[model samples]
Target: MKRPHLIVDDEIAVQELVGHWAFRAHTTPIQIFNRATDPFLPGVKTHLFRSLEALDGRGFRNPVLVITRWKIEPSDVDRLEALTNLKLTILVTWSGIDDDRVEPVSSAIAVGSLEVLANSASRVKKILYWRPIISGLNDTNDHFASARRLSEFADATVFTGLFYREEIRAYFREAGVPDLYADVARRKILPRDAERRILSHFEGRPIFRKTSCGVAFAHGVPDFNGHFGIREICDICPEAQHEICGRKHHRPDMEVVRSLARVVSLADLDGIEISDRRIEVSGSSEAQRYFMQHALNFQVHDRAQPHRQHRHGRAEIGWE
Candidate 1:
């Protein structure tokens, strides 16, 4: 089994990515804590915390691939770094050249968090810079400035193409950022020229471009061992860099299935069959189908397991 992917953010999409990777890696499901309602699967090696504050009281022994946003403070990072066993990767998104011009969602305070991580004693393994392309707003010369600034700190940068969503459209209008928001109000994909122009800014920088979530930035982690959904484009996924899927078969470990079965039963799911490395749920309700599908695809750790209970001292405990 490989190191478990530890996701520390609240983004459902990112949580799902790590969960998918856990199944593909044939390891325990990604342990996630978004500071919200508890995630499914409470008996296996997977875990979901009520909040980021809960982690201060817990410890992990395995070399976990820690994926988190740059929202944590230096003090929090210091404590996390104290756990020498875990590997850390910080993800941050920016739109403007600096904090002052960026959106409140990507503000100076948020950028300060990145700086805090960089200065912290934790020695973060990787820093992935994310730039969500927004036309006229961040797609101008300002994009180059942001990319250049990113090169100063990040190991790699991922440029995510913007998509049209009602919330996003409404956000730009409500935020009072003109032109750019209106430009993207109806459009989804960033124009080819705009993408090229933004990308060109990082031409000579150490931080190169790969359009994706931060996963493509991982250096030691195997790409095939994980999964990316529609975001699994060649330029973004490191697995595509080596062609792991074509060369090797990625079969789910039966133990993972068995572990997930416990979650299935707990979810009150019936008509679920596990065989031949495949899970089939017959004549199930929509909620049951959703439960079973997510359970199988993600980590299913038992938070109530005595061994995984909170420990304050240096005695590192395994999530398993």
Candidate 2:
């Protein structure tokens, strides 16, 4: 959370928005939520099911990412399994953080949901989304062991760090939680050593650095985010997936980038540079950038946020 923000859950508005978004979705390889709450909650599952049912009825074949940390019953599996068109992936978030101020819900809930899905949900893909793995918190050897045991029940596992923004810092400060990062960062606050330890702990497990990479691996496809160009990020990627992504990694022609830029209204087409790994552009919104990235299946970078050599989307806090 960047700031104390007010959220209004307008069901009609969201349904209309999803309809319009799906109406406009023509082969954009991925549709991420882009959801306010945990979709599998009792209060929210109806909407989640209804929306996916509608999308499947419309025969949309793109991958639909369902991010949740709540419970998933066998009925939920049954309903989701009935959907035949869309490639549905449920990303179950678990941090293994003990601090109640940071996370009120127990990670055991996620563990139960993952086990349920692993046993019954064959049509749907499940991922143990081990995240917010801050140092001196959930990055211990025991935490890794717990996550490793949990990972056996998942199609794949993706680990990363926190979005320690100003608002979160203030919240933690008032809650008596220790300061996480040196300061607020636009990118996530995952240190290099933390990442290294996680990699070493997992060894050759189906672990990934990026959510897209995990989803891609689960589906037997290349990363829709095109992370293969950033080879450092793929250091822990499974060997088969490395080859899959490598085969699919091709730089887009400049004319193609220009045409898509025009479509997305990226005015500075001249500033768009086709690099070996990522497409660099001067001015573009996140939505616009993601649209182009999915359309081309390549990484798109904005000039405002320069990616460092080893750090993909992380802050420079601990890397120094």
Candidate 3:
């Protein structure tokens, strides 16, 4: 039996992890769609529906859809059902809204409002919601009823404390709302230890905490047998410099990153050999170019090798 296929449309890093996992599972074509112009677009939904329908019609029964915090409308749901003729599994970041005080009906109602078209045709199975007790937002009583309602209606519930609070706060600060951090810092939703446990559960491995740019980050345990590090594109093509790196240097494209993340996660779970053939990097673009040329000089060097030892630490990858 081959491993199931996962389609991920989130961050590049996440796609990489999922791809790594898929490769280990003996799944073919661990693909990533990071280039999706607008995941929520009606056109994208039609594209997915058509693609999934074609695959299912062609006997690809083992398929799974993995989305990260992307909202779906009701019309999209209807189209998906019409195409695939199967229930869809959805993963959502419940932390975006207050889950403690809102009733399930309220949450469902909110979703229904947003998904009027899709909701009319499809149903949601295995909804994983992560709830974190924010410091100042610890008053669960405010939203507990609604959350419980949603949980009861959900097929499967995976609860986690708020793991992205610091990241969210950092984003706000960078967007010129640093003071919002103060308010968030005062919440008492999920304690640091509990948050660690929640992350470990989904990752199925140990979790490490790191601080970067005044934000707290969590790194999942390395999937040693899966792709674990960034594949700096510069290492493979010295002249492929792009503006993405803010310099005349090449950087790993979004699709590559997503593919690696998926493969790593699947590999970690199934215990398979992780591909280490990724680009190497130095401190700066100039340094990276130098290293790329140096690596290419070796007669046996393929420019891409399984440099497993140089994988990114958790904070750098931002799984937390």
lDDT for each residue of candidate 2 in 112-190, tens digit (9 for 90 to 100): 9999999998879999999888878888989998999999999999998999899989999999998976689988988
- My TM-score estimates for the predictions, one after another, are 0.50, 0.92, 0.39
lDDT of 3 by residue, 104-208 (tens): 222343343333422353333334344443434432444444444444433334443333457666765566542422334222224444434334342422122
RMSD of each: 14.0, 3.2, 16.0
**Once model 2 is optimally superposed onto the true structure by TM-score, how far is the C-alpha of residue 317 displaced, in angstroms?**
1.0
Give the whole-model CA lDDT for all candidates, comma-separated: 0.42, 0.84, 0.34
Write one digit per residue (lDDT tens) for candidate 1, span 85-190: 2334455555553423234344454467566766773445445455556556666686577557855656556564455557766666676644343333222345
The order of the candidates by TM-score, greatest first, is 2, 1, 3
Which candidate number maximizes lDDT?
2
Q: lDDT value for candidate 3?
A: 0.34
Ranking of candidates on lDDT, top first: 2, 1, 3
Give candidate 2's root-mean-square deviation (CA, Å).
3.2
Model 1 misplaced stretches (Cα beyond 4 Å):
1-73, 84-87, 97-102, 121-123, 175-188, 204-213, 224-232, 236-320
Error of 1 at 33 (Å): 6.6
Query: Relative to the unseen true structure, what is the C-alpha lDDT of residue 289 in candidate 3, on a scale of 0 to 100?
Result: 30
Model 3: how far residue 104 lies from native, Å: 21
**For this target, which candidate reaches the highest TM-score against the unseen true structure?**
2
- How many clashes would you count in candidate 1? 7
